[model samples]
Target chain A: MNKLMMPIRGDFVAPRFDLATEILIVQYNNGTLLGEPKTIIMDRASDEGLCQMIVEEHITSLVCNGIEELHYNFLLWKKVNVLDGIIGNWQTALEKILDGTLQQGAVLYPDEREASSYESK
Target chain B: MFTPDIKSLLEGIPCPAMILDHIFRIIDMNRLMEAMCGHVTDEVRGIHSELVLRSNVGNSRDRLFKSVMETGEPVSTEGDILNCYRRKIPVHYHISPLSNSENVRSGLLVVAEVLHVEEIKKEQSNKSFSSAGIIGYSPKMQQVFNKIPLISQTDASALITGETGTGKDKIAEIIHNHSPRARFPFIKINCGALPADLLESELFGHTKGAFTGATRNKAGMFKLADRGTLFLTEIGDMPLQLQVKLLSVLDDKRFYPIGGEQIISVDVRIIAATHRSLREQVKKKMFREDLFYRLNVLYIHLPPLRERDVDIRYLLDHFLNKFMTGLGRNIAGFTSEAMETLLGYKYPGNVRELSNIIEYAVNMCKKKKVGLEHLPGYIFEPVADSPVAAGDDEINHINHQTSQPQERPPSLVVLPEKTPESWSDIERQMIIDTLKKHNSSRKLAASDLEWTRMKLWRKMKKYGLLP
Candidate 1:
């Protein structure tokens, strides 16, 4: 079976091992936790294109330290698995997960459901 | 036979209180209760407690009431949002088992009091604070506001000069939102908000090993704003030494992020704003003159609120309806006297201060309309006295020089020694020598003569051979 694809933070410089086939590592600015940090030039087919790269690159998993809920859901809907709370060496992380040595920490999904419940209380 | 005594006992409790019989029928209500629900008392009295509290009769309130009746226990609940006579209000309800001297369950008594509606409105308004974020429509503001879209039409740097709180940041936002690169990124850095070292690191970013606290490589504002627009607010506060480096970036879009050897090439548009006069800062040696000129291209000056007297009333109404809706109050509007006072006072904090004043009045108002009584105490006081007579004289001199042409033909009765004339004059010879040294370049000649380009152009156009 094809392994799940997750994005990793750019600062996770070391290569760690996990069950996933490969880690979709990325570098981005603060506040924008998913996808390309740039909003301009992303929709186009020319240089620095965003959508084209996401589709053509055969990306499957995104492992990051922190990913915004919007981006996490977008990746998941695109047939990509999102694994977060992983930092440091990418290779070691992958090996630890593959060999059952890494303690998979809890990944936080933003409590979007609580936002609407403010009126209830 | 004892029912009359029981009803009298229930009416003695203060506040809007109600008592219900064993069948959940309201037996009696207090004097305050009658005044509060005066017109609707007939329909409400002798009605089942459930019927009075529950209009739809099928919602969560009914379910809780049924449980309270069956269990024979006093139950209290809070915040059942309901639409009462087209006004949204929250009510806290209390239900208790009615008992006689024998301690047997007779019926249930329910009571409620209306919480402060203003408090709920305040919370709601906090959620909608983006009203004045930037939707200006006044003609004077429109003139400046309209030019914002034009800012993003080109990559050339723009400088916005205005008094504080004139919506300079909003103007910057308009430029970014309307630009060709709007979707990319628009980052703003307040130059005066930080110290020199911190500001530099924020603009240029730093490498992991660049500084003491540098733990990881960080992207600077310029790099983050790459391929987009970077708004630098309060540029006048930038240190003189940093001004030189910034000028180099304006001259050539190249810079090395701190501690990194890579020469990053960024296609970024710069939009800078300041409350201080850059020209004055340059003269004071606080700002670099060359850098000032570089950013001065496509200059925009926002008139202070005092100058745009027409916007006060319009903004006042705008803010009132805005705050009222946000506070969830059907406030008809501000009283004429209150609005007049607002218009007469010169807003030292500009539009921001005006919004604050309206917000403050809205919170303090007990009636539907804001009045002079609700106005802040300071609005009525005389403005502070001032002492800048020397500065006033300098300002007058500037105005005087600006009004009259600098190169007007020497007064008809000019002093012969002061006005040099003649074909072979030393001044004329020196002009020719400098002109030749500049290789006949008008720009170069203007620079060498220490004159404005416009002045040199006029001179050349007058003398001919400007090309």
Candidate 2:
């Protein structure tokens, strides 16, 4: 069984780890859901407090957007696998993590036509 | 809404360009920006700009974006942009407001230009003058820095003189840290903090049951600082009776604890500091002449922050960066008007006062830049036109004016009703008035004025007032 936590805003991952106030915690076993995911809302956004929650809850993995180096190092030191700089929908990122294909800095959004057009310019 | 015209405009820009909504959420970015930040536009289309750019400016990004949108003006600043790969690229950002066809505010257009490494190197070189966390580049401070090594080589009793906030204690610690006794503990005691009788017991130690409340046998500061450095701060406030005992200890390197029959000896180097003139204290029969000579064998005087004119701006930048990171606030810098006020104001409390002012301003400031309104009110208080003779009316007036409602009340001590030639005169007069108001009780005066007893004592010594 693996416990994963991801800071979320609406349907997408929160942009900044330090500014995240709502988090989604889910427990899964062998790429299958074991129970319903839980959501915790914090009174205020604090990186230190979030790190404490992750440790206290025994979260094995953290999927987020942007994170400062200090907090990233601290999470790593605690032996928590951190997948940072992941953009786009939280649902898509979660599916990728379940299938064991999510990578750091992954952009899971499907619509890349506009991006491709801009690149051709 | 991603319009064709805005998309074309972004593509036309040569440098990295991004369009942000009024709330600073990334709406779209050109291919250059995507390449620079290591993210595709579709993936971060609705994400906040700070998450993608991760600029060193921190939380100030929101304020800068809001300012541009509201004021319809372009704002520019220099900082590092941390991309997805955690690479820091020094860049200059220019942000301007984007309006709709009806001229109603809509969003923002941000352009980023990467700066050359040589430019960053030039700025850092100017900050090379620092030692042991003590930063100063002024000539006066340079002289003090030059003398530290020479003074640290000897075990002689040294005297350090400076105003209350001139970093005397830091200098003493730096000297001790660099000295041969760096391996040993460095102990410090403020002479002005305790009464003579209590100070005697604290310094020389007391036997169990020697006096009331002496429940256990205690090791004196001298014992704790064996083969180390003992720093005596506010030495001018050492009572006249205790001066003789201290003098004896310096000569014989031994002392008897109160009610102790055993002879205890300790080898400890003494470093004494005072905001007062020990020579003048000796002349007034308040300090012992022989003891003054013993402590003054090697003297180092620290000039006040005002005298080190060049250091003010340097220290301001240093403390700004310090507090910004500590508080997690992304303040770019002080507004020109705020900087002018800070530079022009007389720091009556010296470096300590300046540091406090900056901390307070940083906490109050909410925008990208700190403005004059964010500064403490005392900086703007009007100085008196002439020296009014000491009276109740003037004191009451000052108390009433400075008592204006604030998150932290300004000091209520009455200033000498005149454009005092020096800040010291104002501080001295204020201390005298506060002491008199509390019937000369140091504890009461300190409590009433929201200052530490040691701070009040140091100020009294600086003003040559008897405790």
Best lDDT goes to which candidate?
2
Candidates' TM-scores? Answer: 0.48, 0.47
Model 2 alpha-carbon miss at residue B225, Å: 0.4
Error of 1 at B202 (Å): 0.5
What's the true lDDT of residue B290 in model 2?
A: 96
Deviation in Å, model 1, residue B277 alpha carbon: 0.9
Q: Best-fitting candidate, measured by DockQ?
A: 2
- In CAPRI terms, model 2 is classed as incorrect
For model 1, residues A1-121, the per-residue Cα lDDT tens digits are 2233342323231111211122343332232234432212122222112212443454544444333333333444345544554433444555444444444332122233222111101
DockQ of each: 0.02, 0.10
DockQ score of the complex predicted as candidate 1: 0.02
Clashing pairs in 2: none
Give lDDT tens digits, candidate 2, residues B432-467: 888889898777887888875545655665564642
lDDT (Cα) of model 2: 0.75
Candidates in order have lDDT scores of 0.57, 0.75
Against the true structure, whose TM-score is highest? 1
